[model samples]
Target: MAFHTRSNSFPSMPHPIVQEVDEHLCRLRSSEAASTSSSSICHKLSGLQDLHDCVDKLLLLPLTQQALAKEQNKKWTNELLDGSLRLLDVCSSAKDAILQTKECFGGIHRRKSLPISLLVEE
Candidate 1:
């Protein structure tokens, strides 16, 4: 039997598909940014043991949510929520790390600024 391949005449990225793809890329970028920020904060705050634990907890948030959403068969919502939660968790972990580092080194809370509130509101 001969294998057949489809013709390469498909239309270049349909408008809706392009939009969806763009949105997903943006989400992935945002998630990456958050993860980087959290890791940086953790590195800076390596002196604080509690902050390390907090960061670990936050890192698990997205994984937990994704698993639950998949079990519930909420594919679209799960994807969106997983992205959002990952971002939120990373930001939160970073903030906690920064705060703990400041507290250990300076004896006071120094919160790191982040845009997490906007996502929480949604």
Candidate 2:
């Protein structure tokens, strides 16, 4: 099933970076049903990476910089910053966990491929 895209609903959000991020999010959501496979996980991770790249590009825009500077002290701004920090922390932790799991699995595969004699030697 196809997921609804929110970009059209947000006509005021004309920036290309915002649109790119929205597209990535929509694609990720639409593919959620097939998320059982490693390839699907990789696709979702790539989408998230694209979203982060879009966010970095958005931050580089002069308009974005000015708006952030203009409202840096507002409550909403503070909340946004706090939320972004939390997201960053969660992403970092997730990356670490994924790496650890991958390493563990790699070791398992390596052990499984070893000759029986080599296994006994270990």
Candidate 3:
């Protein structure tokens, strides 16, 4: 016996409110392209767009902002850490060079009572 699987998917449909908003936006653009446009109409449409954007933001998952902030903070932290590590490596190299210089000249001490500056001058 063969088993049959049923399809549970539904057809996609545009939301009525979304369709209305799109029509309103198209009308606003068309009016703007037509002869001298009134600034007040443009201002109202701008405000409406801003309100729609705010509503869209409200619908996003609560953790989205926190995740974006965390990602940016992590990027900044990595940059600071990388810069500190580079500086540390430079310091380590300088210390090694100084130590190697001292080691090379230690066996050929000309004056036992002189400071390193005087010994170097000698």
Candidate 4:
């Protein structure tokens, strides 16, 4: 399946850093899926690293009272919702990558399967 791209619904532009990080993640995942051997696992690891960077950048965005007030006044942007959905898609892709890696490594124990929560935190 193709990965879903982030929606551009918000009136305000997304923090440029967010776009860069997301693009990096998408590229990493796509490349990994086309590769063989440990390279795919390495790509997934790189994607996680990029995700961490994105989180850090997101935290640095202005969350001051004035900014929050303005944000509250504006209607929920489509871009914001789209970003969230895109992140969810990334999470799913990451989980699949991990599972495939584990299976490739023969770590799958038929008697004790890992819980879904292991892939997605509740």
Which tens-of-lDDT digit does each residue in 29-71 have in candidate 3?
Answer: 6666554333444464454565455435543535444653586
Ranking by lDDT: 2, 4, 3, 1
**Model 3 compared with the native: what TM-score?**
0.31
Candidate 4, residue 30: the lDDT equals 74
Candidate 2, 1-122: lDDT as tens digits:
99987655545658878888788888878887875655666667777778777877987889777777785557766886787788689778767877887899999999999987988854
Greater TM-score among 2 and 4 belongs to: 2
Best model per lDDT: 2
Q: What is the clash count for each candidate, in the order shown?
A: 0, 0, 0, 2
Per-residue C-alpha lDDT of model 4 across residues 15-87, encoded as one tens digit per residue: 6777887787777767754766566666666676677677666646775224535756445445555676787
Off by over 4 Å in 1: 1-74, 108-122
Ranking by TM-score: 2, 4, 3, 1
The predicted structure with the larger lDDT, 1 or 2, is 2
- In model 3, where do residues sit more than 4 Å from their true spots? 1-69, 110-122
User: Where is the poorest 10-residue window by lDDT in model 3?
Assistant: 35-44
Q: Tens-digit lDDT track for model 1 on 16-87?
A: 434544555554445544544646546433423333444345435665457655756567666756766776
Q: In terms of TM-score, which candidate is strongest?
A: 2
* Candidate 2 C-alpha error for residue 105, in Å: 1.8
When 1 and 4 are scored with TM-score, the better candidate is: 4
C-alpha lDDT of residue 83 in model 3: 64
Q: What is the lDDT of candidate 4?
A: 0.67
| Model 3, C-alpha of 48: deviation from truth (Å) | 56
